[model samples]
Target: MPNDSPYKAALQKLFRTRLVARLDDLRQALKRQSRTTILHALRAVGYLTSYSHAGRYYTLERIPQFDPKGLWRYRQIGFSSRGTLRATLIHLVETSPAGQTHTELQDLLHLRVHDTLRLLVRARELQRKPFQDTYVYLSAKPKPASRQWAERQKLAPPPAPKERNLARVIDILVDLLHHPEDDARAVCQRLRAGGHPVTRAQIETIWAHYHLKKTPHVRSRHGRL
Candidate 1:
């Protein structure tokens, strides 16, 4: 194949045919006086790639082969997948069934989309709702977002049972006082085994009410965390 390197022989004449480089590497190779000045100059020449992780890695446009969706990455840095991060994010959220979270989006795209998502939300191009201690992204339209919220809630686990009665509450406290070292499940086992009506769920509530320290639970292989 014909040499497709952008700099071709020019790169060899300078940095030995290395077409892509970080700001410092390029500056050293070119014997440039200023890194900041050179970076801006490179951007003007259309050689800057998108920053990823914590705003570090950089490469040239040709170093990445952008997929149809306008995305690609090398090592830690990535290239823009399409138009703008904001646009790509909107496209993903629009087509998603369960929407997406900040971490989820980062994991999938290999780039941080938090700032773009914020901009999109403010512009009403997307919607966000609280779900399980975190916000889930959703469609901007009311109907789709509403449906997603409903589905998100429907899929959530049921709340723990409550011990509203005073006598039941006393029984729970008494058990805890007698078995100070017992974990929630252990207390429930003893209570139920002795014919009490209390459940592990109710025991958990008592734990929360008094700000009691919970025993460290060892998760079993069967997913018993």
Candidate 2:
């Protein structure tokens, strides 16, 4: 961008302090009226757009530091310091302390990556194992895959609270069957409205009992979860 252009000056000033922005953020920051306006401005500034996750955020031509994951995220937005989607995905998988899974990668990336994951596995860059109804992405190399599984076992939520009160629990389970995506809090709210004394903790315990789902915690750019 030309040094004297108002857009360039504004972006440089803003980016000096805050490093990245999503489309909405840029539109608000630039006091623009439309997505097209922001897109045009971004093109002018030669900005780098996120290629993984939501791909909603943009950065100036460069950012100095990145995690071993090769990405930085603030809230729902992410900036991939690495060059492209495939490259960034490879970096994330190859350097991970343990191999990752489609769900785990999707959570970290905040977008769907199963197709890419399958492609990687087919290319011999990754491997996988059947887990529950899904698969855990494994390292093509054995050692890391073994370590990842060991850690995964170690990290598995301890044997879920033993199920008691079969009748009430079954009712709750049937209720959850209708909306398979409800979280514990949501389930609790609906159940309470229906006059059940279901606590979020109780619902969580139930999910544990069934081993329903596992949410993996990802490391930040600095490598802390």
Candidate 3:
């Protein structure tokens, strides 16, 4: 916006609805209101009112917009970056009090362990427990579901499938499940070794179909499908 634009004037009016300030500090003080008021004013009046710098012309150069307001709300609602991961981490930690390990976060969050940890650390929503390598979500007060929810979560059903697989895949899974404590990846690798081709996702599919315990350390044990 121009330094003397009407939109800016409207925003200033909206912001100054209940404030008093001298001419010098007026701008800074108005900009420092509660986020709700500032956001409301921005949403109601802010737009990319273009201007120039150093005589280099620009259009819609850096006008404030409603989309970023949506983004900010989304972040608060757990929809992007730390919001997304923090949601998953919170669920995992609350559901599995053992606290999800690095590998589990990768699978559950569909993110690299380092990236998940970094975001969690940056947000300060999660903290690593002392004398241990595990992280737990921080809370000023205990939540209603902090521990009870975890107990109920233990009986939650398997994840639903995204796509259909061939019947041959089903047959192999049936054969594998017939064997107890069957190492899922090992079984997959054995199938690969025997030239029975399948994707890792497919193998995981087979395991899920039979309701196997698909833990990260499943590779360490061999048993039923």
Candidate 4:
């Protein structure tokens, strides 16, 4: 945790995400709604905190902002159903190198295709290697951690220069998407000015993958079964 961490700040910044909204709504709804209603809302929002006999409660450690809307990026990628989806994806990919495909991973991890895909895409932690029609999810080359001043300065193991460079570029692209109001053309141009080789095609791909438009499909009464 940094000294300037603004987590304890006002609700405005905190509730900007979907997950926070869900959690807030649930807390409020529970006060007015029935137990059943609260339970259903909790299920939808992935809140399953269990309490034991002695009033002891147990659940995974979570930050205050761990709500469904904050999970929009992952959901957009296809990681279906909330509930530790972020941690699970990181653990799986970290242990299993060469990356796991959509179907193979879904079965292995007991996740639906949509959910799995969404997490993989949002985290930007997986490297997508194209093999014919589909893509393979490889572990993103992690950046080497810098040694502390207390320790002897040693050359830390670094990921391949190319991988590290690509990761930095992609990371910036993801950040840009978060602020869609930022002009894409101007952002790309500024990045290029800073000596980054971010081409229009690469920018387009990032936009397409992250900016998922979820338009509802309406079926006629007769067509609806």
Candidate 2: deviation at residue 196, Å? 33
| Candidate 3 pairs with clashing backbones | 48-63, 177-225, 180-223, 180-224, 181-222, 181-223, 181-224, 182-222, 182-223, 183-222
What are the per-residue Cα lDDT tens digits for candidate 4 across 1-225? 222223222222333443323334544533434545444433443332321111122122243333333222222222222435555555555445245566656655444555545666677765554443565555566431111211212222222225555665575566475654545565577678877777665665555555533223456978833
Top lDDT prediction, candidate number: 2
Mind giving the per-residue lDDT tens digits that candidate 1 earns over 1-225?
223243333334443355345656665654556766555555544564454544344555545677765677666556565535676687777666667788878886886677878888999999898888878999999988887777767666645335466677777789878877788888888888888887787788767666677656567889856
Instruction: Sort the candidates on lDDT, descending order.
Output: 2, 1, 3, 4
Predicted structure 1: clash tally = 2
Give stretches of model 4 more than 4 Å off: 1-83, 115-119, 142-225
> In candidate 4, residue 154 scores what lDDT?
26
Give the whole-model CA lDDT for all candidates, comma-separated. Answer: 0.67, 0.72, 0.45, 0.44
- Model 3 TM-score is 0.24
Give the deviation of candidate 4 from the true structure as CA RMSD: 22.7
Which residue pairs collide in model 1, if any? 70-81, 71-81
For residues 1-225, could you state the per-residue lDDT of candidate 3 as single tens digits?
Answer: 223344456556544553222222433544543544433434454322111111121112122222321111111121222223445455555445444556665554434556656676577655443213444343312563345334434535555554454555655666565654556666777777867776667776656766666444343357633
Instruction: Assess candidate 4 and give its lDDT.
Output: 0.44
Model 1 TM-score (2 dp): 0.47
lDDT of 4 at 126: 56
